[model samples]
Target: MSFIGIDLGTSSLKAILVDGQQRVVADTARALTVHRPQPLWSEQEPGDWVAAALGALHDLRDAAPSAFRLCRGIGLSGQMHGAVLLDEADRPLRPCILWNDGRASAECAALEAAEPASRAITGNIAMPGFTAPKLLWVRRHEPALFRRIRKVLLPKAYLHLVLTGEAIEEMSDASGTLWLDVGSRDWSQRMLAATGLDRSQMPALVEGSQPAGRMRADLARELGFDSPPLFAGGAGDNAAGAVGLGAVAAGASFLSLGTSGVLWRTTAGFEPRADRAVHAFCHALPGLWHQMSVHLSAAASLNWWANVTGHTEAELLAALGETVTAPSPVLFTPYLSGERTPHNDPQMRGGFARLGHETGRNAMTQAVLEGVAFAFRDGKAALESAGGPIMEAVVIGGGARSGLWLSILASVLDMRLHRYPQTETGAAFGAARLARLACTGENSGEICTQPLGSPEIFNPQRDLVAAYRERYDDWQSAAEFSRALQ
Candidate 1:
């Protein structure tokens, strides 16, 4: 049998087809764009996600028809914290409020004020990026629309609804909404009340490795599947990426360089450090939890620079050669969309300092890479303070393709980074593994084992590490600039 995994990402929908042995048969992706209707507000039409996801699957089917026909299971993973409100007719009331949207800051504070034990309940601080706060923002500003809401689904859960005709959510993704008792791996009643929502609006919850529902018969027929595919309760993008990297055991970790930068570490138990802005959420698997230090921008910063400079990310990165001889002459802080992790200040914008006349494209590009690496250093320290240090990390995401970025990351954070094949599609691959687990009831450890081949490892260089030690200090000072940018 073959399994399919789909990851609904902010900028794309990625899918992979794998055989029973878990070897990738085919992979495809469809580009997606985020719409910014107003400053600090990011939104996407709900219909676009369904279209892109189906399109990606169609691409996979066309690429390998024989392999696609044998598909028995599917797993879903997606960007977390999106608020998708559905009307009574099961249609989206408006465009989804995206994970990176910061327009709900005031609502974040208000939610905290209303629920004093919110941190204790959700194991997370009330952030504007969370779903509950977005609802609060809508309730206050768009009361008429809020009143018509019939269901609240995360992006992946909305997809689950469309595929199965049932609204179901899994633990890992639900934890990000500030509506789950992360320690218990279930929805928290108090949190729902605080957000002016109730159980009826929430979807049924499941573990990420369990079956949520089967694909609708029509969807199955449309995709050429002989039977309705079992939909695994996949995961949030970060958790699915962890599963893909085999970062399920305690202290296992990965640093993701996607649209947002994330430092993820699995914990043996629930560990909450909301005081430090460290995210403590449930793992996709039961009896496990994870912590993350997230920055709103990582690869997105490079993408932005590439867009403004009229160069593809590949071309811009190629100009820098294999590695930098020294830290960039100028310093940059990768806080383009404000920041998270150690600094909860969403108003702390990023910028460059100490640029000289010699600062050209290569120099600026090196700084951008180093700056993101330095930001990871901040995340490293925060996670350590919350628990212990993450000695090494599997580097995954689009940025993992860049040898220079990995070199700089290793030197800046002084941790080894492992780069495996298919580094960019780790989440979708992991979702496939989850589908396998859900269908065959296999031992997770065996199913989610680390890649077999010897991975190319990026180790820290003595001289570069020393140089970065000082540069990181300089980066920190600049990162603390102000809230005035808001």
Candidate 2:
């Protein structure tokens, strides 16, 4: 038997086919773009996601035709907090408002004022990045569009509708909407009311491992599958990545340096530390919760720097070798797309400080690498200060491919980092694992083991750790000045 996993990322749509042995048979991706019609605003046409997923599935089917025919189940994982409003006919009302968009800053405050217990109910701060704030923004700025809304869905839920003709959302993704009573693992009527919504507008919620819906027979045949596949309730990107890394049990943890950076730790129950800007939400698994301190830019910073310098990410890293001898001469703020976690200020922008005449491309590149590491250090401190101490965490994502960046991040956070062979496809792998559990009814704990390999460990060096600490302190002061500019 085989299963499929789809990860709808900010930059692309990825699909992976895995056999019963948990081996990846074939994986493919289709590029996606984010549109910014105005500053601090980001949107995407929902139709693009469907087109990309269809195209990617066909590519995967062509790569492994036999395995594709035996597909037993499918799972989904996606970027969280994207607001996809639907009309009465189940069509998108407008372009979906994305998680990174900061245009809802005023609405975020208004939301909190409208519902004073928002932090307690949702276990999250009223940040512009969350789903409820975006809806509020639409209500005030696009009142006519708001009037036609019949249902609301996160990005993956919208995909679910296309795949199964069912309106469903899983817990981990719903937790980011600010309409869920995360402690209860269900929608909160009072929370929904604050945004001029009700439970009827929300999708049916399920745990990530459960079967939410089955594939439509007509669509299944059209896509070349001999039989319809079951659809598992998948997870938000970070939670799914954690499941992929076997970080489901309490205290198990990992850090993801994807387009965005996330410091994720699984917890035993609802633990709200919203005051620290730490995200407390449900884990992909039942009865488990997680806390994440996120930075909006991580690998994205390197991508930005690479684009500016006319070099591939690999080329830039090859120039730096495996480690740097000292702290960067310059400090970079890494807020190219604004800031989240601890600051929660969407208006804040990033830049470099203390550049010298001697600074060259190498020094600037090193600074960019160090800047993301410093931001991770900030998030680590926030999570640690809230009683979750930093020890070691498995690291995944495209950024984990950079040995030099890993070395810097290890020393900056003074924590051990582990990487497995399956780092790059962790989210999709986790989603595939969920499909397996749903199809076979296996124990998730047993099914979600570390991928087959001895992990490459990145340990902190005493000298480098001390050096990074001093530089990180200075960077903190500089970050405040940047935040003040907002």
Candidate 3:
């Protein structure tokens, strides 16, 4: 048997076909566009995701027809905290307000003012990126549209609705909505009410490993499937990526250096630490939870630097290799997109400090790399301060491909970092695994605990640890000054 996993990412939609042996048979990705009509605002039409997903699946079917024919289940994973509002006819009310959008900052403050217990119940500070704040923003600014809303869904759950005709959400994605009672693994009526919503407007909740619904008969037929595939309630991207890395058990953790950086640790039970800005949310699996320290920018910082320097990422990295161990006199703060973990400041901006005539291209590049690593270090410290300990971390994402960056991250965080062969297929692979569990009736622990291939380990350099610590201090001071300016 075979299963398909679809990842609805910010910039693209990726589909992976995995056989029973857990081997990837065919993978396809389709690029997506994000619209920013105003500063600090990000929006995307939900229909574009549906189109990209369909095109990706079509490509997958062409690449591996046999596996496609044998597909027994479909699983989904996607970006979290996006608000996709729908009218009574199931038509989208407007463009989805994305997770990185900072336009809801005022609404976030209003939420906190109206519901003081929000942080205690949601286990998170009110941030513009979360779903609840976006809803409140709509209620205030788009009152007519808000009144027309009858249902709400996260990005992937919206896709699920398009696929199965059911508006259902899984735990991990719902937890970010601020409407979930994370400790109880269900929707919080009080929290929903604070945002002028009710349970009826929310999608039905399910665990990520369970079946949300089966594939629509018409869609299955149109896609040339021999049988309808079971649709699993897949996870938010981070949680799904964790399952992909086999980090389901307590104390298992990984660091993701995607557009946003995240340091995630799994736990056996709910543990809320909102004081430190550590995100406490349910895992994809039932009765399991995880803590995440999120930085709004990671690989994105490198991308921006490359763009401004008029060099490709490859060119920049090649230059970085020559000055890998050189300490940069310049310090960079990577809050170009604002920050999340350790400081919930939406007005924060990033820049380089202490630049001089002697500073070369390599130093500036190194500074950017070091800046991102230091941000991860800040996240690590926040996670630890919030009572989540870490002995090691599995590092995955676009940035993990760079040996220099990984080395710098290891030294800066002072933790051993492991890299898996399947790092590139992170969240989609995990969703495929969840599909397998749903289709075969296997226990989540059994299916998700299988070892990832032998990992390459990056150990902290003994000599550079102290130097990186000093650099981190400088970075922290720079971050503080930037926030103060805001």
- Taking every candidate in turn, the Cα RMSD to the unseen true structure, in Å, is 1.0, 0.9, 1.2
Strongest candidate by lDDT: 2
Quote the positional error of residue 238 for candidate 2 in Å: 0.7
The count of residue-pair clashes in candidate 2 stands at 0
State the lDDT of candidate 1 residue by residue for 380-419, as single tens digits.
8889998877789898999999988999999899999999
What's the TM-score of each model vs. the native? 0.99, 0.99, 0.98
The alpha-carbon deviation from the true structure for residue 325 of candidate 3, after best TM-score superposition, in angstroms, is: 1.7
What value of lDDT does candidate 1 attain over all alpha carbons? 0.91
Measured on C-alpha atoms, candidate 2 has an lDDT of 0.92
Model 2, position 112, has a per-residue lDDT of 93
Ranking by lDDT: 2, 1, 3
lDDT of each: 0.91, 0.92, 0.90
Better of 1 and 2 by lDDT: 2
Ranking by TM-score: 2, 1, 3
What lDDT score is found at residue 249 in candidate 2?
Answer: 88
Clashing pairs in 1: none
Candidate achieving higher lDDT, 2 or 3? 2
The reply for model 1, stretches above 4 Å from the true place, is 482-486
